[model samples]
Target chain A: MLRIEHFTKTYRSKVAVDDLTLHIAPGEICGFIGHNGAGKTTTLKACCGILQFDKGAITVNGHSILTDPIACKRDLAYIPDNPDLYEFLTGIQYLNFVADIYEVSKTDRNQRIAHYGNLLGMTEDLTLKISECSHGMKQKIALIAALIHKPRLILMDEPFVGLDPIASHQLKNVMAQHCAEGGAILFSTHVLEVAEKLCHKIAIIKGGKLVASGTMEDVRGQASLEQVFLDLEDTL
Target chain B: MIRTLVSLRFRALFTGLIVQRQKKNKSSKGTVILFAFLFLYVFAVVAGMMGFTFYSLAQPYHMLGLDWLYFSMAGLMGLGFAVLGSVFTTQNQLYDAKDNPLLLSMPIPPRIILLSRMIPLLAMNLLFGGLVIVPATVVYAIFVEFSIVGLLLQLLCLAGIAVLAQAISCLLGWLLHLLLSKLNKSLASVLYLVVFLGIYFYVYSQAGEILTAIVMESQQIASILSKWVWPLYAMGMGCLENGGLLLAFLGICAVCFAAVYAILSATFLRSATMSSVSRKRQKLNLKTSKTAPPVNAIVGKELRKFLGSPVYLTNLGVGLLMAAALTVAGVIFREDLLSAFSMIPGFTDLIPLLICAVLSFLISTMYISAPSVSLEGKNIWILKSLPVSGKDILNAKLLFHCRMTVPLCGICGFVLALAYG
Candidate 1:
């Protein structure tokens, strides 16, 4: 579970996220929807201990990201929108490095790497340098690295951007499985249909303010996710 | 188009040097002032050293009627300093620059783009050139009167010599890029360190002997050197006796510069964009890997980073390589080295201690953390999101430095002490 209360972040005098409060329960997949510069990325980054907020607290599994960031981070994994892996390292080497950071055992890492490598069709290319990978391949490697740690919370920013259809389907299944195992996911996406289908809870943000947030059905009511998002944006 | 490219290049280099750091640390007034003072101090010391050397040479040179030797030495020193100062810049700006695609994709002519890059490099060479030529010329002008034509020739030769230096450095950079493409990355870094240190230490250790020799036997040395260095001979003649020699010297420099520019226009795009390494897929073997704590993993990652890039490796690990080289020299030349030190009172017994101190200072200066942190650039999110504290990440970088420095320094210190004993 992740909770952020009264979070405020600013770049100079310009607020990127203003007085934001959010929570994700265990066994829930929360889709954060926002237009460009709407603070979704900022909020996600702060929750993952990547950014320091001006005011408020963020907790990952009851550990404060600001005060006990290491403990908080250990229970969570974050995949950024651009997966800039160490270009010099091979794909397997990068995964191994990540696994090592989380202190995964040899047997566990091997099993997960094999399972994910085959699932993502990256088994043949694990020895290639990350610099040699295409965008989709890099995304797949990043996803695999994020999963290798087996964190209680997973946060992703635009996680579907470079994925192919089969990989996207695979990712959806993985997210479902992770949620079923009581892990929470908070992801930002531009695709409303995917969020509508995949997310148990949805939040819409505009101009650094949350416009609506709740269970997907409660927020959308009779309207399609896209229609509701458009209406909310117009009101914003 | 040339102006735009030049501005872009200037912005890129200076933005890192000035703007970004200041913007991030806007509250630090003391830091800014300290940096300013430090920069000024270094500049003053360098200028003072050059002034003293030129002034000391002026009277003797005038008395010996070896103005040609003086001119030649000045020109050659200027060229040498410029080239030495610019090799790394050439490597970065010409071959492996990150902005190649962004600039190349524009509709600007390729030759214009080449000129844009070359201009800043030329400016840097000229700056270094000025440090030598300006003080030397000023000393000559003040100590010895010259005719109007002589002064004009001298001025023209100075400008021509700077162009010559820039052209030669560019060609050397081109050759380096070619060599880098063919060599193994690790071996290339080792080779660069050895070559650079060899040249540096040789000149540093032998400078006093060379200066004494030049002072005692200027005429014979000048005559012999003049034969091998004709443009310098021409520059001297143009400044003292014959104006036509100055024109000839200028013509030679012009020809060389034009040739370099022509080659750059013709092939620079291909050369600059050429990838230094070729990628080949290795056979995949899925094997279980033992895990370490996060700090160990990060240190291992940092080590791989250091080893992966020849440029980065040489830049950061140069002191370690130098220490090793010094240790071997200490062993092989123990007798000769001590004998040389024996001439100075009370210095012979402290030679080992001195060597250790100097080596320690060099080792301490080789901090990779500051630059490595900046090197993360846009990819910093990886570290930020990792299940590690800020202190752990910093410690990882520090661990890398310790691992590289400690053992090497200890061995060198031991070798020095053992040789002395």
Candidate 2:
């Protein structure tokens, strides 16, 4: 389970994120939605221990992100909105480097790399330099790399932005499979349709505060998710 | 439009420099100290020039005699300015641009972009040139007993010469880049090294001539330079005792400035356009291993990353090649270097140790084995979110660095030991 308690982040005079509390249990796919500068990236960065938050306690499987960042990080994989990998490295080389860090056994890494690489249609490109890959290709490479070590929790921000529809569909399936296997996912996106169809639960943020959060049925009551989202946004 | 672009460029350069300084943990105190030292050095050099000018002016016979001294001073200043400009423009500009995505996406003309970038190059060169020229000219005025008109002319000439030198260096750099773009990796490295060495050799040879002229035909130096008809004419005529020559030199400077500007504008646009057109996308098919080797899988990934970019590979891999080339050349030319080494009393005995130390330091510093974490740019989150400890991630990067450094250092050490023995 992943838990974020009373998380708050301030940038000078403006509060980017207010005291926000949330939790994700195994097998849950939580889609995070927010407008530009609504603090989705900041929240995700804080959860991944990439950006330090002024006031918050984030823990993964009872390990504190602040106190035991290394342990906390061990349970999570994060993909940023614009996936900037080392352009100098080939796809395979980057994967191998990640595997070495995770201490994935050679047998497991090879098998998993093959499976994920094939799934993402990146098997041949693994040998080519990443600088040579297109934006979508790079995105796929990043996805496979994140999945290489099989962390319990995955945090992604705008993962589908540059992806083709086919790649996006494949990724959605992968996310579903990951959840079915008892892994949890928390991702932020502006694509309403994706959030509506793919998410088990949805969290909406406006002006650095969570306006609503819960399973689709729980949050919307009788109204559609889009209607609820628009009504909440209009109120803000 | 030009002025605005220049101002924007200057701000960008300053901001980029500040960002770099911040990353290196430099404080205001260090900058203050550096400027203080520079001020003292400039003051002393300028004071000496004033003393020389006064001495020459007091003796009419020495009026023309001091010209060679001025010529050598100008050449030395121009050379220094050229080198500093080249190093700054070539080494840091591209690296600085890497982090600035917004600048790359700007709608401004690419030539405008390139020229704006080059503004800092010109500005830095002018600053250094001024430090060299102002002091020397001030001293010349005091010694030569020249009128106010003569003094102003000499100053104008100095400015013209600095501008000309800056233009030449910029042109050379662009031409070199155009040529290098067509070469493969290994050849490109060799070509670059050769060009650098060639320039160094040319400068060294010229320095000897300049020194000899200062001792021999001092006054004739300015006269000879002035007679050359273009930039040198302006500088020479400005300092000449004749008022007519000073006006002519100023006119020449105006023409030269116009020509340089026209050439720069034309070349910059072409270069920028070429760069944009040359960027091609590749089709890749990334394959995964059926059975991953424990460390190899990860190491393979790192190898690909290192070898993927020309810039990264050249910066890191070229060090090993450089060490190897130097070692082989040392062995081949052992007699030449050893003979020179033998002349230096203490250096002979310490050559082996010196070689080992130098080679080890060079390999370690030049090849960035583990800058991988920082190099990851935005993808750091992906690595962070992995089911791995920070230590493990850091260790992987450290291991990558070690993988390259250890073997190269060991090889160089062995070769040095064998050669010395």
Candidate 3:
């Protein structure tokens, strides 16, 4: 479970996120939708213990992200939109490095890396340097690294941008499987169709404010996700 | 078009300085002022040394009836230093500049881009050349019986030499970039280390003999400069006595600069357009083992980064490498070194302390942490999102520094103690 209360983040004179409150229960896939500079990335980053909010409390599995960041981060993983990884390291080496960071057991790391590497058809390229990888391949490696520890909560920012249709479908399955196994996911995406189909709940943000949030049915209600999103942007 | 690119490069170089100036806080503003004063002090000291060198040489060369030789030697030495300093900066500006892609994508021609990039490097050489040559010129004007035309030619030669130095350095920089590109990344650092060691050995081996000959038989130095080093002779003749030689030297400078610019624009544009990273795929072998703790892993990554970058290692790690090399030399030649020190007046008692002090100074100067954070740039978020304390991340950098430096220092300290005993 993840909870954010009255989250506010300011950059000098500009307020990036303001008075935002959000929560996600176990076994739920919460899709966060917002336009560019709408503070979706900021809020996601704040929850993942990467960004600090000016006035708010964010807790991951009852551990406050601000006060107990390591503990909060232990149960959550974040993959940024453009995953600029260590270009010097080979794909396998980078994955193993991240595994070590999260303290994954040897047996678990081996199994998880093999499974994901094969699933993404990246096993053959595991020895290739990250700098040599295509955009999609790099995205797959980052996704695998994020999932290596099997955190209870996953926060991804535009996780679908570089992914191909096949990889995107595989990722959708993985998200569903992760949620079904009692994990929660809060992902920001511009793809409303993917969110409409895969998300158990949805949150719409406008200018750093949460304009609408509820179960997918309630948020859209007789309107398509795109129609509902456009309506929210127009009014809010 | 060239002006825009030069301004962009200038802005990039002074971004931090500009930011400090924009700050509202008094302390930040004070730092900018402090840096300015520090820069001026360094410039003044360098110029002062140049002036002193010319003043010392003026009387000897005047007596030898070779005032031109003195000017030539001073200009050559000044240009030599400028070339040495400009090589690294030229390499950074032309080959490794992060803005290359953005600049290349624009509608400007490649030669204009090359010229624009070289301008800043040339400006730096000019600063260094002026510092050295201006002082020498003033001294020559005061002491030497130079004609008005001679004095004017001398000043022109000084500026001309700076441009020539920049041209040579840029050529060398372009060559290094090309050579390093063809070699494996791991080998580049090792190759640089070997080259550095080789240069050090050559300088140290030759310095005593060269200095002894120059001090005991100064005329021999002038003969060598005038006969073998034709450009130096031409420059001095042009500057102090002859106007025709000055025009010839200026003509050479212009030709060299144009030739280099043309060559870089033609040959390097293709190489520059391509990505810097090697495209060879690494062989895959997945072997599972128990991973290191987070801090250890971080330290390992940091070490890889430090070792992987030839520029970072060659420039910043030089001190650490020197300490190790010196420590080895101390152990190997302890008896000879001790006897040599004992020969000096009141030196035997302070040998151990002197060794320790030198080692400490070398270790203190290797601050890898200073630029390590900025090097991360876009990838810093990966660290921030990891399941580790901020303290651990900082400690990882600190520990990496300690790991590289402490063991060698400890060994040297032990060896010096044993030698003293």
Fnat score for model 2:
0.46
Residues B1-421 of candidate 3 have per-residue lDDT tens digits of: 7788899878877765646332433456677788889999999888886677567777777887777777777788789878877786787788877767887788888788888888888889988778888888888778876567766777788789988998899898887777767776556756766786788689668966754554456677678877887777778888865767877788888888889888888976785765666656655555645599999999988988887776778767887777777778877888898889889999988876787788879877788877787777778889999988878988998899888888988887787778665
DockQ for each candidate? 0.71, 0.41, 0.67
Q: In model 1, where do residues sit more than 4 Å from their true spots?
A: A132-134, A164-166, B21-37, B146-149, B184-190, B215-228, B309-312, B340-363, B366-379, B391-398
lDDT against the true structure, each candidate: 0.85, 0.69, 0.84
Question: Residue pairs in steric clash, candidate 3?
Answer: none
Using lDDT as the measure, the top candidate is 1
Candidate numbers sorted by DockQ from highest down: 1, 3, 2
| Share of native interface contacts recovered by each model | 0.86, 0.46, 0.76
List clash counts for every candidate, in order.
0, 39, 0
How do the residues A1-236 of candidate 3 rate in per-residue lDDT, one tens digit apiece?
Answer: 99999999998999999899999999999999999999999999999877777998999999999889989888998988988999878888889899999999888898999998888888878888887888888999999999999999999999999898888989999999999999999999999999999999999999998999999999989999999999877886
Candidate No. with top TM-score: 3
How good is the docking of model 2, as DockQ?
A: 0.41
lDDT tens per residue, model 2, B333-385: 88888899999988888886788777866776564655666676655665565
Q: Estimate each model's TM-score.
A: 0.90, 0.76, 0.91
**Considering TM-score, which of the candidate structures 1 and 3 is the better prediction for this target?**
3
How well does candidate 3 score on lDDT at residue B189?
59
Model 1: colliding residue pairs: none
